[model samples]
Target: MTQIEENLFSEFWDKLNGATGKGFGKTVSIDQDIEFYQELKYNNGVFAAFKVHRMQNDMAARLLDENGELKSFKQWLNDVQTIADHQVEQWFRTEYDTAVERAHLAAEWRQFEREAGVLPNLEWIESTSVTPGKDHKIFWGVIRPIMDGFWNRHKPGDRWGCKCGLRATDKKPTPVSDLPAGESDEPAAGLDNNPAADGKLFSDSHPYFTDHYGSKKNILLESDKLMTKYSREEVRKHFQKELKGKSLMLQASQGLAKTISVSHQDIKTITGKPHKYNYMKNTCCYWLPQLLKKAEYMGWSPDMKGTAVPGHGDVKNWHYYRFPLNNEDSFLVVKERMNGEFRIHAIQDKEHFKENKLKNPFEKR
Candidate 1:
């Protein structure tokens, strides 16, 4: 990843899992017509960006060698294509599905809010959540008139993972004067409109775009398609032509003792973020080269049994290494391809290491 992706947007690269999915659910996938209609599915299974970089910058950075030389295109492409065969499927069916589902659900409810606009009053109903936001509960049962601008902004689903909604009621409207302090006065950033009023399935303020790439968020989202576009030979040509780098040794880790190939899919295993494996962010990419140079070897283990990869051979053996990230106690496991090179197996946390008795690096495996 480039310094811009690695540092300026490290949050998108380093810790995207924890706080993403905001501003997302306000719009459910729906098409506008003479009458509003929806089928409850994503706009497309793939999130395509009409404007995209096509792996010119951030991806090109990954091709650079230890000496700051760019690796031959053939080398970088082989590295990218060697990544896990089925990682994209797991993410789309799970994470992307959840995001679109939330957006659909929220948009569905907003339709109710818009239809109820003719009613004199719509009451705010704040529901429970495992992860709650600042003030949804404070306005619980708040009945404001339909014409109040407050109704146009600030609904329950306005916040990420929020379960708030507006209820239709003809009861006496709560006076604006009754709000305590500054409560319910301003809509949160990016959530200033009703999705039902606007015909988009997502609010423009979605953090998937705002917090990460701003207007260019779609570049990252369209990646699942990017991963399946090339073969090892083809992609190497891509890297060679695109990067115009020098020849590559059999292994990029010449002076280093051991090397592990970190693929785009392997990244999601570390952060649990839903992006497809087309590129790497430097935040986690640093671990790989570092592991090759200075990490303690933790030996091999039987590859976890799972569904067979459809078109790829399964690795029966796996290798592990322990390295320090800031202060995190973690292990990087590499999978062996029967006829190919070594690729990452998993990036597990301290608790996972403890459960398997791999926490102490000096402890014999």
Candidate 2:
């Protein structure tokens, strides 16, 4: 018999077992040559011989391949592992995009409901992620397009569909503060009766906006439905863009009567004194670029022009004309008092904006 026939017959005998029943002295033999080989007639029940044989060969091939090292099986296993990793990464990407899209859609739906004055049964399910909370709250006005895109293109179980079912639960209860002494855990005995809980409850209730909130600080005023109704430029003009910087001085009195008082008399004594020679007395602030250019104008040397300011050679290559003036530089001319309004432009100290306190533009000698 051939190798294929031998493999087939081997599987056939393994399946045949326990022949003591109704067939009185009857016996069955394995057949391999017949192409129409259907069932193996046993004393008990019939079995599909060809099908079982084929399955045996396939299983044998798999086991042998798996047992061998650096074979086709190893290669196939590696490929399968790679595919599984790729699938997991793809799932994470899809989930992340969906989370962002959901936030945008929720914001848009809320806007629509507010505008129409019709309360819809649709409540938003937020993704259980902390990273997007701040972003979700901001730019809420411009998120309608993103929401519409997801809503129209996504179907159930699609990449953008909400499948994770991950939602935020449990909010902290407002604590009671300034509560009066009582037998039971009750509110304050004050006239208002509602004790402020840990001061945080009132803090949360108070209107809080981010550093850039309601401001065109870095935002460009664009024409939109909301912008048209409530002009962006008009609203942003009043927004407080200034940051609260470190206080050089301290307040003397407590609540209501509080006023800033200079405690460090030594600091005032050292910094308040006027310069003796007054190098800036006759200098014009407009000619600052000319003074700066003494170091170099792109590549021109000081010998080709006037005397270069010492130690300013490093800044010569710097494109100050294209660059915004340092706010500290405002102090340089501060020494050279200008007769005009003395208005400080916001752009002068774009990066150095620390509190409202002015930085000395002129480097101290």
Candidate 3:
């Protein structure tokens, strides 16, 4: 590796180690939280380099091996030098894309806070590139409702290798005809202009912009350790407080509900299910209350009725309630016992729900 590469490797190593609470070379004190973020950024950079450089996964794994001690700077240098010039360019492009997105989101978040309640709409002001294409020109100075389909769907820097950025503006955007004409005849470099064969526009090709733009604020806030550490009950209570008196319909429930409740045991049961999807476990903690809330609104009408739990013999009074949670349907199996106590036999996602369908006593009938 050259001098610059050597320095960069050393810096990354130091930051990574320091973030893990192990100082390198000299003891450099840093706030643990700050170090955590720095460590993530450095790790992302390394992984991006590995991916863009097309380094084999096994080689990357070996470099990170910590059986004995951290690898030396020379060892890292040897590994990095394997990356070719084109790979380095790809790595830079990835980094540039991420940096631009983060900066834009940060600025937008700040402006959102500053202009709260003052600006109901925002416009995307694309940076005037020398060779603006039809795709770029169409989006230039276009005003749209913030958080609506058009704005959410066509945020700047959505396309692969796109360098164009957007500035949020409150003032009405100037008409396209009134805007200055493009200076160059060619389209923007590295941009794909051809629409999808189905006639989907270039903007529609990328969906991340629509899914993530509106959630940027919540995403950043949730990244903090404190926010992530909230217990399931706490999260449920918070949402309940927020949704109180609001007419919210659960897609699965198909009706407006007043309140929802999930016991701590319910959370435990769902999360502790063996062979459950990893996401089902994670989302159960956060989405359980929401699902229950929707369930309450839906009035507990089971799509499929009269199920029985296996191994416990036939029970005719059992009912199943299915609701959507985090893009997947989850089911709550409940049986009313002779003593009048409601017993929850199982709480499962759509996958498990399907697997256990035969166990349902009503399925046979």
Query: In order, what lDDT does every prediction score?
Result: 0.44, 0.24, 0.40
Candidate scoring better on TM-score of 1 and 3: 3
Collision pairs in model 3: 257-297
* Prediction RMSDs, each to the true structure: 21.0, 34.1, 14.6
The collision pairs in model 2 are 175-197, 176-197, 177-196, 177-197, 245-355, 328-361, 329-361, 331-361, 332-362
Question: Model 2 over residues 29-122: C-alpha lDDT tens digits?
Answer: 1121110011111200112122222333333444334557545666655545544354335633442343233323333333444433332222
Off by over 4 Å in 3: 1-77, 80-121, 125-141, 144-154, 159-268, 272-281, 296-319, 326-328, 334-347, 351-365
Ten contiguous residues with the weakest lDDT in model 2: 32-41
Q: How accurate is candidate 3 locally (lDDT)?
A: 0.40
Q: Which ten residues in a row have the lowest lDDT in candidate 1?
A: 33-42
lDDT of 2: 0.24
Error of 2 at 295 (Å): 36
Model 3 C-alpha lDDT per residue in residues 1-365, reported as the tens digit of each score: 10113233333333333323321222322211222223333333333222222333323444653675666777856766656443445644453444444333433433454463677456666654565445555566666445444533454544444445544456664554654443432332222222111111222213222333234334333222221232233444554566564423222233222232334444445444542333333334444434444442212222334235432443334445665543356666554443333444556666665534434433332
Query: Per-residue lDDT of 1-365 in model 1, one digit per residue for the tens?
Result: 21122222222211222212342333222122111221111122122221123223424556877889889998877665523222234422343333443454444455545666466677876665666566667778888776676655556655545666566678888787875343554654444545445433344454333544333544544433332222222334444464344322123232222444554444434444222222221133323454445555665654455346541356755566665543345566666666545666555555555336333433332
Clashing pairs in 1: 25-103, 27-201, 27-202, 73-236, 73-239, 73-240, 74-236, 156-164
- Clashes in predicted model 3: 1
